[model samples]
Target: MVLVQNTNWNNAAKALKNISTATNFQLDKILNLSDKELEKLVMPSGYYHNKAKTVRNVLGMYQTSFSELKKLDTDTLREKLLAIKGVGEETADVMLLYLFNRPVFVADNYTRKFFSKYFKQKFTYASLRKNIMKNFAFTVKDAQEFHALLDVYGKQNK
Candidate 1:
């Protein structure tokens, strides 16, 4: 999945992983949780109430489930994801890539910095991610590794 090394990502992901593990990765069970409960579980994420609400709002859009969501064509799923109130491009792409095994590249700050600096070309989020995907065109694993390496190397340099 998304292996971004930002503190917020690390904390939030660990909290979510714990919750998913305890609930057997059942999105339904997660949705069934009370707002207060979900907030408490996600406290480590910061803005727990907001994040919990966002998670509920996004997940509520799904009528079926995870496997069913996976069955949807990537375009349809991406549209549905982007329609959510607070979900942006990177967020949507992260879910698609990590959760659904879609080969979409995630353009994060580290990615932008690394690419623009190394390539000596300023790039927009979509353009940079597209360039990375185009150049690495082959497999999802390669894209994941590239993103992870950018984060890892970015952290070290910082």
Candidate 2:
């Protein structure tokens, strides 16, 4: 969520690297940091304060029920994630696909634009997600690659 929310990819990557290094990529260590420290760590990403809060909030949720969340069906898991602040549909789908290894397409703005250009159709987030899931048969990896490619295409076109 922090990585793609309003910030450019390079800035987000730098912020993520900084946070990972400081926390040794450990969730507990990150959670242990004071909010100001967490905000400083993610400064490069911009919107550090809100991003820090979001990171804390989502990780707090994970720290408590990660295993239980993983066991949930995709729909239930998506709903649970969506309920968290700062987790939009794209971020929720991202966690479902990458973290949980669920087969889901992230119909983010990039994907929406890609489809609009090539398919000559404009689709809302839910509509495109539903259309892709219903019409295409993709494994988790395939969906990941497709979303990445769409992001790459969108970036290049921009």
Candidate 3:
């Protein structure tokens, strides 16, 4: 959740480090933190308060249904993640692709922009993801690399 809507990789990494250090990488400890405490730790990541709440909510969901969620098919898992308060289509697809090693493409802004600029085509999240997955048989690693390459290229070009 920390990476969702966050662009500064350095700040995200620092926030992760702070949280992990404070909690000793323990889920129970992280879950026990007060909102203010969690917000303080994640302050560098921006939108600290909302992000903290999202982090807690996502972790709570994981704590409760992690094994079941992991076993779900890609579409099912994406739907479940989308049901969460802070998880939009991009965040849901990100969790599906990265956390579960699902092959669904994350139709994030970078992907959408890159395609739209080059192809003169507009795509909604579902349409872009569907079209890409339909056209390419991307393995987990391929999807990861493709997403990373798009991000890097987008950053550089911008």
Stretches off by above 4 angstroms in model 3 are none
Q: Which pairs of residues collide in model 1?
A: none
Best by lDDT: 2
Candidate 2 lDDT over 1-158, as tens digits, reads 65667778899999988987898879999999999999999999888888888899899998998999999998999999999988888889999988888989899888899888889988999999998888767899998898899989989997
Clashing residue pairs in candidate 2 are none
Candidate 3 Cα lDDT to native: 0.85
Where model 2 places Cα greater than 4 Å from the true spot, the runs are none
Q: What TM-score number comes out for model 2?
A: 0.92
The whole-model lDDT of each prediction reads 0.73, 0.88, 0.85
Clashing pairs in 3: none
Native-to-model Cα distance after best TM-score fit, residue 129 in candidate 2, in Å: 1.5
Give the per-residue lDDT digits (tens) of candidate 3, residues 71-144.
Answer: 98887888899888777888887888788888878877788889999989898888898888888788989989
Clashes of each: 0, 0, 0
